[model samples]
Target: MSSSTKPRRGLSALAALAGIIAAGVVLGIAELAGAFFRASATPVIALGSTFIDFTPPWMKDFAIETFGTNDKLALLVGMGITIALLAAVLGIVAFRRWVLGVAGVLLMGAIILASVLTRAGSSLPDALPTIVGTAAGLLALRVLIARLRRTAVGDPAGASTATTAMTAATGGRGATGVTVTEKDDAATGQDGNEREGATAASLPSAGTSRRGFFAAVGVTAVVAAVAAGGGRLLAGARNNIAAVRDSLAFPAPASPAPALPAGVHPPVPGLTPFVTPNDDFYRIDTALSVPQLTADDWVLRVHGMVEEEFELSFRDLLDADLIERHVTLTCVSNPVGGYLAGNAKWLGYPLREVLARARPLDGADMVLSTSSDGFSASTPLPVLQDERDAMLAVAMNGEPLPVEHGFPVRMVVPGLYGYVSATKWVVDLEVTRFADRTAYWTDRGWAEKGPIKTMARVEVPQSFASLEAGTVMIGGTAWSQHRGITKVEVSVDNGDWEEVTLAAEASVDTWRQWSHELSLESGLHTVRSRATDAVDGLQTEERADTVPDGASGWQSVQFTVK
Candidate 1:
C-alpha cells in the first residue's frame, strides 16, 4: 500500500477508536448520574426496557425459547454489541464530517432521553443523566477528532516555520535545481516519493499530536471504566433492600399449607423437586432489572370501579391474617415440556378477602394488577374471588420473597399463566371491566385470560441422554395447577400408552410427580408423556405454538440405549 494510503487508513481507525471511547464515556457518565437518581434512568436500561416493550410477541417467544431464564442477559449482550458497532460508525463519521457526527450523537441522546422519560413513574429529573452524558460524549468526540486531524496534517504554523528555515538554508534550491516546495513535497512523500526521506524537523509535531490523541483515549477509557464500576457500586449501596429482605421476619400463617405427602418426591434421580427451591424457581418477565424495594416503604393501592378505595401498607399486610398454600406457577411463554413451571409454598393474604373489603362495583370483572416497573396483567375478578387460593404473596417456600422474584409483594394465582395472573413487584390493582383495559401482554396480543395448560415433561433421562440397555426408570412431573393431575401416561417409541405410578398428590394447586419402569433394547428411542387433569381433560396431542394462550402438545424426548 502507498505510504499516504496507510496513514489515512490508520487515522480512520484511530477515529473509530475515538468514537468507541466517547461512547464509553457517555454510558459511564450516564450510569454514574443514574446512581443518584434511578438505575432504570440509565441509557442502556431505558433502551433495553423500551425494546422489550416494543418487541413483537414472536420475537419474545423466540428469545425465551432460545435463552430460557437468561433471556434478559442475552438481550443486554445483544444491545451492547449493537451500540458498539453504531458508536464506531459515529466516530468515523464525525472524523470525516464533523457536523453530521455531532448530530448523530445528539440524536442518540434524544432517543435515550425519550426512552427514560417514557418509563413508568419517570419525571423530568430523569432526563438529566442523558443530557449530561450526551454533552460529555460530544465534547470528548470533538477533542479527539481535533487531535486526530492534527495528526493527519501536522501543526500548520510549525510546518510553515520549518519550511521557511529549510528554504533559507538550501538557498531555495537543490542539486537538481528543484524548488524548495518540490523538495519538501518529495521529502514528505506528498508526490508519492519515499517516506523515509521525510524531514526529521516535521516529525515532532505530528508525533506529539498522535501521542496526545492516544493519551486522551487512554484517560477516557480509564475514566469510563471507573465511572461505570463506581456507579454500579453506588447504586447497589443506595438500594439496600436486599439487606432489609434478609433481615425481615415473617409471622406464622393463620392458615398454613398442609404437610406434604410422602413420595411426593420420588427416588428417581433428575426428577424435578416437588417444591421448587426459591433460587431455582423460573423467572420470566419484562423487567430489564429487578425492582429494588423495601417492605417498610411498600404499599398496595386498590381503586377504580370500587365502592371504596383502600391502600394497604406493608405493615398492614404483614399484620393481616395470612394464609400459606402450595401453588404451581406457569409462564404462558413456556413451550410444551418447558421447565418454566414450578411449584412453591407461598405465604400471603387471600386476594378475595382483600378485594372483598374494597367492595368492587357490579360491572367490574377484571383486576388490573401493575408492577412497579409498569408491567400490568389483567386477571379475572371471579377467579380471584372464587375458592381458588389466589393471594397477594409475600414469601415463597418459607422465606421472604427474593428480590428478583418480587420482595415486598407479588401476586400468586394458581391455574393461570403468569402473564395474566402472577405479577411480581406488584404495587397497584385497579378493579375494572376487561373491556375497559388491556394488560401489558394482552396489549401485545396475548390472550386476555391465560389458564395454565395440562402438561407433563420427561426428566429422568434427559433429551438426547444415553443409558444402558436394561430396565430404566422414566420419571417426570405433570401439572394442571388448581385442577390437579389425576394420571400420567407414558409411551415409548410410539407404542401403546401405559399408566405410570403417580406420586402422592400434594394439593390440587401443585404438580404431581410420576415415574414408570420400562425395559429397553439397545437402540435409539423416544419417550412421550401426557397428563390427565382432575376434570378428565387429557393433555392435547395436537401441537400449538405458545401465543395468544398457552402451548399445547405432548412432550417427547429422544435418548440412546447402549
Candidate 2:
C-alpha cells in the first residue's frame, strides 16, 4: 500500500527476470548440447512416431497422416509442449518471494522426476539426457530459490515487506524493523516513506511492497518467455550444423556429361560422367523426419570411460590437422542390384587421427555413431583402425556433405554395411564394446553386423519380345564393396555372356561404376548381369531377403524396348 515501495519492487522484479532469462539460456544450451551428443550416438531422423514397425500397408498411410515426412513440420511438432514445460519451471522460479522461489524449485524437481519416470527404457536413449537436463534445471531452481530467500531476509523490511505498510501504519511491527533508535527510527521511517513515495511515483503505483516482488514477477515473466523460445530453436540445432558441414563436404557437381566420341558410347546408357551427386544419395533411417539444425549450434562431446573428455566445435574439427581420403560406401539395405551404394572423394580428419588422440583402451571394439534425431549405428573400431580408408569425412564428392546425407559428419567404413559402419549426421562417437551396445536399428530387429553382399546388375537388354527391330541401348551398375568389381557380363535369357567395358577403378573402397551397352530390337526382354570380384568370387544365384546379412544372386531387369 505504501507509495515508496512500489518502484523498488518493480526494479527488483526486473533484475530477477533478467536472471531467470540467463538461466533459461543455460537450460537451452544444455538441451542443445545433449541433442548434439545424442545425435552422434544415433540418427534422429524421426521423432514422435507412434508406429516404428509392425506396420500394415494402410498403417503407413495412416501413420503418414500423423507424422508427415515433410521435415520442417516434423521438427516443430512437439515444440509447444517443450516450451510449456520449460516455461512452467522458469516462470515459477523467477517470479517469487523466498518461499515462492522454494516452491518453484520443488515444482521444477517434480516435473523432472515425472519426465524420467515416463521415459524409462533402454530403448529410449534420450531418457538419460532428459533426466540429466531436468535434474540440472531443478538444481538451478534450488540455487535461485536460495538466493531469493537470502535477499528477502537481508532486506530492511524482512518478512513484513509483503505487508510492511500495514505493519508500519498500525504501529504493530517487530524486530524485522530493528527499531534503530526511536529518534533514528522516526527519521529513517520518514526517509523510507519519502523514498517509497518517490519510487511509487516512477512505478506503476499500484503495487503494495517495499521489496522487489512486483518487478521480479514482471522480469521473470519476460525471461521465462524468452527462454522458452530459445529452447525450441536450439533443440535440434546440431543436425542443422551437420547440414552446413555436409554442404561443405559434398558440393554440386561441375563438368556436365562428357560428350562421347562418334560411335563411342557409355556402356550403361544412363551413366553420368561423375558418379553420385550429394542430393541424390540414397538415405535410409528410422528418423521419420530430418531435424533442422545449424552449424554454429553444433558441438561434439567425447566423455565417459575416457582419460580425457573432449568437446569439439565445428571450427575445432576444421582446424584440426587434416587428412583426406576417397572411399566408396555401401548399404546393407541395398537389394542384390539396388542403387544404395556409391563412391566419391571424401575429405576430413582421419579416424586414426581422432582415435589416436583419444587413446582407447584395448577392450574398445566398437565406436557407436549417433545422430541428432536419436538414431545410432554400432561400428567396429578395429575396422576403422585397420587398413581401411575409414574417415570422419566432412566432404562427400568435392563440397560439404548434403543435408539429405549426413551433413556435418558421418562414418565411412569400407567393406561394412551402413548399419554396422556408415553413420550419417553423426554427433557422437562413443568408444565402447559391441556386447554392451545396441544401435537404433539393432533394437528394431535389424542385423547386428551388416556386411555388403556381393552382387551385380544387368544394364543392357539381352532377350526381349517388346523391342523394335531397330537398335536400342541398355546398361546398369554393379558393386562388391571393398573387394571391388573387377569383371561384369551381360546375358540375354539363356544367352551366352558378353563382356562389358568398365570405368577406371579408383580404389577397392570406391565402387567401380561400370556399364555395358547393347543394341536391341523392340520386344519384351529379360536382361541379367553378373559380376566377378578381384579375388575371383563369382556372383551367386542363391536368392535371399535383406535380413541377417546382405542379399545375393545376380540382378535382372525385364522390360520392353522400342
Candidate 3:
C-alpha cells in the first residue's frame, strides 16, 4: 500500500486484465472448434438453455413481456455480460492467489458440465469442449500471472543494499552493464538525498515484461474477435437447410381444404390479415436459437405405450398420403385479445393414422412429443386420435415450413393451445400418461391440457384510431377453432350488444372475420367484441391473465370520432 509499491500493484492489475482477455480467447477458439460438429455444443448455449430451464415462470413471463420474440437474444446478452464480469474477477483473484483462480475456473467448468449433462440426449462427448476450454483458460491465467510476478519494480524508496552496491560498481548503471541514469551521489561526490533520488530514478523498471504482457493481451483479444466472427460465419453457412427445403416440391394433397370465400376477410383498414404470413407469424418458444435441420436428416421416432415402435424418416413423411387443411393456432401465453394467434393452410398426414400405425395401448392417455432442440409438449391422446384433422405438418401456406417455424416437420392440432399441441421440429412422440410424464410448460405450472379459449379482437378501429363522425365500420377476427364462431357481437361504450355480420366460415378449425357499423356523434368511443362458439358456448366476459391455462375476456379498443 506504500507509494513506492504503486507501480508493482498497477502491473498486477494489468496482468489480471490480460489473463481475462486471454481466457476469453481460449474459450472462443474452443467454441469455433465445437461449431464444426454442432452449434448446440457451444458452452454458452448449453448454459443459457440450462438457465432458461430453471428460470421461474414469472421471470420467464417478464422477459417475454419485455423483449417479445427477442427475449432469447436478451438472455444471451445478459449471460455474456455476466460471464465476462465473473471472468475478470477470477483473473484478478488468480493474479494474487493463483490456487484460488484455478479452483474458480474448474468450478465454472463443472457447472457447464452439469448443464450439458442435464440436456436431453447429451452424451459424454458433449462435455469435452467446455472442459478443454476451461483448462486452456487456467493455463493462460497461470502464464500471465507468472510473468507478472517476475517484474522487480516493487519499492523505489527501498532499493536493496545489493542493488546500490551493484549500481555503484557499474557507475550508476544497471546490472546489465547499461547506463540507466545520471551518476549516483556516491560517484559524483553529492549529498545522500541526491544519491537516493538518482538511485530511485535509475532502477531498471520491468519494461520488457510489461510490454510482453500487453502484446499477449492485444494478440489474444484480436484472435478472440476473429474467432467469434468465424464461428458466426460457419454457423450461417451450416444453416443452408432452408435451401434444401425450398428445392423440394410438396406433393398434391390427397384431401385439400375447400377454397376460402372471397369476402372472408373484410377490406377494413388495420384488420388482421386472413392468413398470417409465414414470416410475420408469432413465435414464442424456449429455444435460445433456431434449430437448423434439413429434411434429409430429419427423423421421427414413435414409441412408448405402443404395441409396435417405429421410426419415420422425412422421406417417409413425404411419401405418406398428405392432406391440406386450414387451422388456427394459438399460444397459451397469449393474453386475451393478444395477437399470438394465426390461421394457416397446413399440409401433412393425419396424426391419428400415424398413431394408429403404432397401435397405442388402451391406458395410454397422452402423447409426449419432443423437438430436435429438446422442447416437449404432451398432447391428449383422445384429441390427437379424434377426427379433428390433427396432423404431422410438413408445409404451411402452400410452401415448405420456414426454418424459424420448424423446417422439416411439426405437429398441428387445431383446438389445443400450441404449448400442448403444436410442436416444431418434432422428432419424437412417446405415448404416455399425464400421471407418468409432463411437458415443458406443464412442469412450470401451466395446465397439462391447454385447450384454446374462444376470443375476439377488434382489429379495425384499433385503440386511438381517429375517424369522422357518422357510420363507422368496426371489423375484426374471432376464433373458437374446432368449435367455430357461431355469432359475433359488438358493443360501444359497454352499450347493448349488437350482432355483427359473419363472413363465410373457412372451416370449424379456422377463424372467422366479422364486422359491424355503428353511428357515432363525436369524441371518444370504446368498442368491445365477443363471440359465441357453435355449441352456444358464450365467450367469457371476465378478464383473466394467461397462466395455468389460456386467457379469456372480451376484446376492447377505444377510438375517437371527430
Indicate which candidate wins on TM-score. Answer: 1
Order the numbered candidates by TM-score, best leading. Answer: 1, 3, 2
TM-scores for all predictions:
0.92, 0.56, 0.85
The C-alpha stretches of model 2 lying farther than 4 A from their native spots are 1-47, 53-268, 303-309, 459-467, 470-472, 517-522
lDDT by residue (404-466, candidate 2, tens digit) is: 677667777878887777777677889888898888667766677775766776534433325
- For all candidates, the clash counts are 0, 67, 0
Among all windows of 10 consecutive residues in model 1, the one with the lowest summed lDDT is: 192-201
| Model 1 agreement with the true structure over 1-562: per-residue lDDT tens digits | 7545566667668889999999999999998988998778999999999999999999999999999999999999999999988999998888766777888999999999999999998999999989988988898888887667656545433333323323443466422346756667666657522322354334457778778889989988998889889989999999988789888899999998999988898889888888899989999999997888898779999999999998999899889999999999989988988999888999999999988999999999999999999999999999999999999999999899999998889999999999998999999999999998999999999999888889998898998999999999889999998889999999999999999999999999888999999999999999999999988589889899999798999999999999
Candidate 2: lDDT of 298? 65
Candidate 2 versus the native: TM-score?
A: 0.56
Computed on alpha carbons, the lDDT of every model, listed in order, comes to 0.87, 0.56, 0.80
In order of lDDT, best first, we have 1, 3, 2
Cα RMSD for candidate 1?
5.9
Q: What is candidate 3's lDDT per residue for 433-536, written digit by digit as tens? A: 88999998888998888888999888888788899999998899999989999999988898999999998888989999988888999998998899999875
